[model samples]
Target chain A: MSAAPAPRYLARPLAAIGRPVLAGLASVGRMAIFTLTVISHLIRPPFYPREFAHAIMTIGWYSLPVVGLTALFTGGALALQIYDGSSRFSAEAAVPSIVAIGMARELGPVLGGLMVAARVASSIAAEIGTMKVTEQIDALVTLSTNPIKYLAVPRVLAATLTVPVLVAVGDSIGIMGGWLVGVNRLDFNSAAYLKNTIDFLEAADVASGIAKGAVFGFIIAMMGCFYGMSSGRGAQGVGKATKLAVVASSVLILGSNYLLTEVFFSG
Target chain B: MIELQDVHKAFGDKRVLCGVTLTVPKGESMVIIGGSGTGKSVTLKCILGLVTPDAGTITVGGQPVTKGDRDAFLARFGMLFQGAALFDSLTVWQNVAFRLLRGAQKRARAEAREIAIEKLRRVGLKAETADLYPAELSGGMQKRVGLARAIAADPEIIFFDEPTTGLDPIMAGVINDLIREIVVEMGATAITITHDMTSVRAIADDVAMLHDGVIQWTGTVAEMDGCGDPYVEQFINGRADGPIEAVR
Candidate 1:
C-alpha cells in the first residue's frame, strides 16, 4: 500500500511539471509553423504594395525619434564611463576607439532594435490582436483575402528591409554623440576623436551590426504577428498578446545578438 | 444550399457543438436561434471554414466546403460580424470597397469608390460618411457601414451574426428591415444567428433552434410556435424553467 501511494504521489507531481513543459513545447512548434507560413506568404503573394508602404512608414520612419534619442544618450553615457574607467591606468586615449567599436558592434544595433521593439512590437500586437478579437481577420478571410499575405507578409518584409537602414543611421548618430561628449566634457580634440572613431570602426563591424538589426527586426515583427494572430479573445486576451509580443521580441533580440556575435566575431 | 451533417466540435474538454445536423435551402433566410454559448457563432464559423470542426461534413451548393480553391469558395460569401469588425485603419468607403479594390474583383480606384459609395447609400448612409474612419462614426453608423460592406461584393450567400445586437430598438428595427430588404432584393441565401425574436420574425423565412450542441427544432417561421419542441418553446419564451439549464 505504501509503495502504491508513492507511485501515485510521484505520478501527480511529474504530470504537473510535464504539463507546462508540454504546453511550452507545443507553443514553440506552433510558432515554427507560423514562421514558415509567413515566409511562404512572402514569396507567393498577390502582394499588397499599399500595405507594405504603410508598414514601412509605421515601423521605420515613426520609430526614428525614439531610436535616435536612445542611441544619443547611450553613446554619451558609454563615453563617460569609458573615460572614467580607463583614466585609472592612463589609458584615456583608448576611450574614443573603444566607444566607436562598442557602439558600431554592439550597443547601436541592440538598443535601436530594442527601442523599435518597444514601439513597433507593442503597437503591431495591439492592432492585430484587436483585429482578431473584433473578427476583422475573419472578415478579411470572407472577402477572399489571405490574412497572412495581406497583413503579416507586408509588415515582415518592410521590417526586414528597413531595420538595417535604421541601424546604419543609428551607428552614425551614435558615433557623433560619443564625439560630442568626448570633445566637450572629456577635453579630447574634436578632430582627433572623430579620426580615432573612424579608424576603429571597420566596415565589418558596421556590417555585422546592420545584419543583426535585420534579424532583430524579423524577430520583432514575427513575435507581434504570431501573438496577435493567435491571441485568445476579448480585451484581456489582446492585452496579454501585446505584453507577450514585447517580452518575446525583446528577449529574442538579446538572445540572437549573442549568437550573431559569436558567428560574426568569435574567431 | 448549405448542409451540415453530424458536426462535432470541442474546445479542450468543453464540447461546444455535438453532432449538430441541419440544412439550409437556397434563397432561404435561415435564422439560427440559441441561448448564449450554445454554439450559434461556432456553427456559422464552421460553415465559413473559419473554424474547423472535429468531425462533420459541410457542403455548399453540393460542393464540400473543404474542397476547391479557397479563394473562389470564399468569394461566394460575405459576412457581417457582431462587432461590425470594420478595419480601423481604413475609411468607411475603403472598408466597403476592400474586396473590390483587390484580388480577382479588382476595380479602378474611382470605380471602386463609386461602388462603395453606392452601397453606403443603400445602407442609408450619406456620401459624406464614406471618408470618415470607423472610429469617427457612431455605433449605429458603424453597423450600417458594416452592412454596406457585407453587400458591396454582392455575394451569393451572406451571413449576419447578431445583426441587430447592441442597437436601440428603433435602430434594431431599421437594421432588420434593411437586412430583410437586402436579402430579398439580392436573391441571396442568408444565415443569421441571433437570439432576438424580433429579428427572427423579421429576417427568417425558416428558423432553426440550436440547443445542447444540436439543432433541437427547425421549421418555417410560421410553424415555429406549433413546433412543440421543448427546447424551442423554452428558448422562444425566454423561460428559465425548461430542459435547458439556465445557469449554463
Candidate 2:
C-alpha cells in the first residue's frame, strides 16, 4: 500500500473502509491499556480512604432505587409473558422456574449494570471532564497527587465492590416481583411458585451473574474515566465525553453479558 | 536554579516550542512574556513535567527534570493555574491545604487548617472564606484563593500561569503586588507566564520574550525598556502592526 499508485476510485473506497476500521481498533487498544492501568493502580499504596468511601455511597447506595424498580417490573412482566406462552402448550407450571432462572442468569445483573452505567458513567465523565477543562486535574498533579490515583482508583474500587451487592438485591427484588404476579394474576399457588423458584436456582448461577456484574461495573467506570481524562479543552469537549461514556458503557454491558452467558451457560 | 536547553515540543504537525532555552537563577522571579500561543505556558509545563517535551534537557537544581522521584520533585514546587483551578468538591481551605492533607506531606488536621488560614490571611482573604467553596467566590476572590493555595506548602519553587488573566485592573494590580511581595518574602525561585505588560513589570526580576516557538529576547526589566528589539517592542507596546501576524 505504501508503494502503490492506485486509481482514485479504488483508493478512495479503500481508504474510507480502512480508516474507521483502524481507528476503531486503535481505540479498543487504548481502552484495554487504560483498564490495565486502573487495575495496576488499585494494588499500590497511599490509598485515598475518603474518596473511596464517597464513591461507594454514590455508585452503590444511591443507585439502589433505580436498579430495584427496573428489576421488579422486568421480573413481573417476564412471569406474565411466560405464563401466557406456556399456557398454549399446557405448560403453565413452568412459570416459576423460568422467572427464577431468567432473572438469575441474565436480567438481574445485566439490567442493574446498565442502569448504573447510565447514571454513574455519565456523572463521572462530566465531573472529571469538567475538571480537565478547568485545569483542576493539572492542579492535582502539580500538588504531587496523581490524578488517576485520586480520581479513577477509588471509583473503580467502589463500583467493583458495590455492583455485585446491587445485583444480589436486584435479583431478590425481581424474584419477589415474579412471585407477586404469579400469585395475584396467574392464579399460581404462592407456596408452589416459591418452591419451584428455590429448586431451579443454583449457587453457580448466582455466582456467575454476580461475576458478570463485576466485569460490567469495571467497564462502566473505566470508560467514564478514560473519556474524561482524554477530553479536549472546552465545554463542548466535556459534553462529548459525557455522551461517549454513556454510549460506550451501555454497549459494552450488553455485549459482555452475551459473552459471559455463553461462557457460563453454553454446552 | 532551573534551566531548559534546546527544548522542542510539537502537538501533531504544529511545533509549539523549537530549540527554546532559558534559565531562572535561584531565589529570583523570572517572568516569561509572549503573545497568545507563543509557548510560555508550554515552557512552564515542561519545567514541571506536566507536558513532556519531545526533545530537550530540563534541569531543576542541576538535576534532570524527567528523572528521580516525581512526587518528591513536584512537592518542591507550587503552581497557580490560569482559572484558579480550585477543586470544586473541596472548600477553599481544603483546596489550600490539599498538599498537606495527604501523602508524604500529611499534617494533622488542626495543623493543616492553621497553615491554610495563615496563608489565606497573607493573601488578604478573611478567615470566613476558608469554609466557602470555590463556587461561592467571585473571580478576583478565586484568584486570591489560588494564590493562597500556591503558597500553602511553602514550596521552594513556584510557577504562576496568567495570574491576572480575568481580574479587573485594580484587582490585577493587587494580585501582582501580592505575588511580588510573596516571592520576595519566600525568596524562592519563581517562574511566571503572562501576556500582560503591567503584570510583567510588577512581578519580574528578569524578563524573557517568546515568539514563534523561540526566545525572542531576554534581559532585566530595565534592559527590556530600551532593548530596541522589534518583536519585543511591538509586544510590549501592544501594537497592531509588527513582525508577528495579527491573524495567524
Candidate 3:
C-alpha cells in the first residue's frame, strides 16, 4: 500500500528555516570568538608601531578630503532647506541658529560619520578580507605576528582617534557652509548670521557631536576588521565581506546616532 | 624536523582528518598526495597552526607547536599558498620583502628593494617585474613570484601547497625544479602537498599518501611506485576503477 502522502512542501520549508537558523547561530558564534581573540591580542606585547602609524595615515589623514566635501555640501543644503521651510511661519530669522545648532549637535557628526564609514570601512574590510581570503593572515600568524595585534588594533585605534577630528573639522566646515548660504540666498547680513550662529551654539553641542564621532569611528573600524578576519576563502568572500562591512557600519552609525543623541540631549 | 603524532581534526559533523600521523626529518623533502577535499591542505594548515587539530601533537624541531608561542614556531617556516596568494596592493618587491620590511628584520628601503629584486631574479623574473603588482602577472608568473617570496627569508622549514595546480606542463616543471633547487640550496625541511606525480617525482625525497584523514602509505620516492597499497596503486596509476570511487 502507498504510504500516506508525505508532507513534502512542509518538510522543505522546515528544512529551509532550520538551515538559516543554524547558519545564523554559527555566524554569531564565529563573531564572538573573533571578538574575544582580538581583545586578547590587544593585551599582548610585541606591538607593531609602524603598522599603527600607517593605519593612522591611511584611515585618518587620507579620509579628510571626502569627509570635508560631504560636510560642506550637507551644511549648505541644510541651511537652504531650513530657510525654505521656516519662511512659511515667518521664522526665516531662525535659520542661522538652527543650522549652526543642527550641524554641530547632529547633522555634522552623523553625516560625517556615515561618509567615513562608507569610505574607510569598505577599504579596511577589503584589504583585510583579501588578506584573509588569500591566507596572508595565516602567513602573518606563521611569521610570529599576532594578526589582530598587527592588523585590527591599529585600524581600530586610528579610526577612534581620527573620526573625532574629522567630526570637528566637518562641523566647522558645515557651519561655514550654512553661513555662506544664509548670507547669499537668504539675504541675511553676514555679521548678523555669524553672530546668531555663534550665539546659539554652545560647547556642549560640539562636544556631543565629537563624542558621537568617536563612537561611530569605533563601530566603523570594528565592523570592518571583524568581518574581514572572518571572511571566507575566495575573491567572492572578500567582496561579500567588504559590502557587509560598509552596510553594517552605516546602519550602526544611524542606530547609534539616535541612541547617542538621546543620551546627550536627554537633559 | 616536524612530527605529527596521531592528529585528528573535524569540522562539526564532518571529520576531515581522522588520525594523521607522519614525520619529516630535518633537511628532507616530503610530498603529500591526495585528491580534492581529502584533507591535504588541512594537514598542512594544522602543521602551520592555522587549523588546530582536535586531538594530536605537532612538533617542529621537537618543540610542541600547540603551545601559545605560534609566532616563534611559525618563524621557522615559509609557505607557498595554493593560489600563490600574493598581496595585490603591494608591488612584487614589496610582497616579496613583506617580512623584511617589518620588526627587527626591517631593512633600509633600498636594501629591501634590492634583496627583493635579487630574489625575483632567482625565480627567473626580470627586475622590471619587481615594480608590477600581482594582478598584472600571469598565473605562472605569480606562482614563480610566490616561490621567490617563500624563499625570501631563507626559512628553515617550508610548505608548498599545490605548487603546480593551475600551471601549464612546462611552467609546472619550472616550479618543480625551482622548489627542488631551493630546498637543496637552503638545506630546509620541505613539506609539499599536491596530486601532481610530476612534482612528486621531481621534488620529493619521501612521498606520503593522505586518505580518510590519515597517512595510508608513506615511503621513499624509490619505494612509492612499488607500494603494495591499493590506494597508492590506484592514485599513482590514475585509474578510476580501483579502490577509490569517484564521488559522482
* Candidate 1 second chain TM: 0.99
Show the colliding residue pairs in model 1. none
Task: State which candidate has the highest TM-score.
Answer: 1
Per-residue lDDT tens digits for candidate 3, residues B87-170, read 776799988898788755668889989999999999999999999999999999999998888888889999999999999999
In model 2, state the lDDT of residue A203.
91
lDDT of 1 by residue, A53-158 (tens): 9999999999888888888888899999999999999999998898888988899999999999999999999999999999999999999898999889999999
> CA lDDT, every prediction?
0.93, 0.93, 0.89
The list of candidate 2 runs beyond 4 A from truth reads A1-4
Clashes of each: 0, 0, 1
Candidate 2, residues A57-163: lDDT per residue as tens digits?
99999999999999999999999999999999999999998898888878999999999999999999999999999999989999999899999999998998899
* Better by DockQ, candidate 2 or 1: 1
Task: Output the lDDT of residue B86, model 1.
Answer: 99
Local lDDT at A155 for model 2:
95
Q: Candidate 3's error at B179, in angstroms? A: 0.8
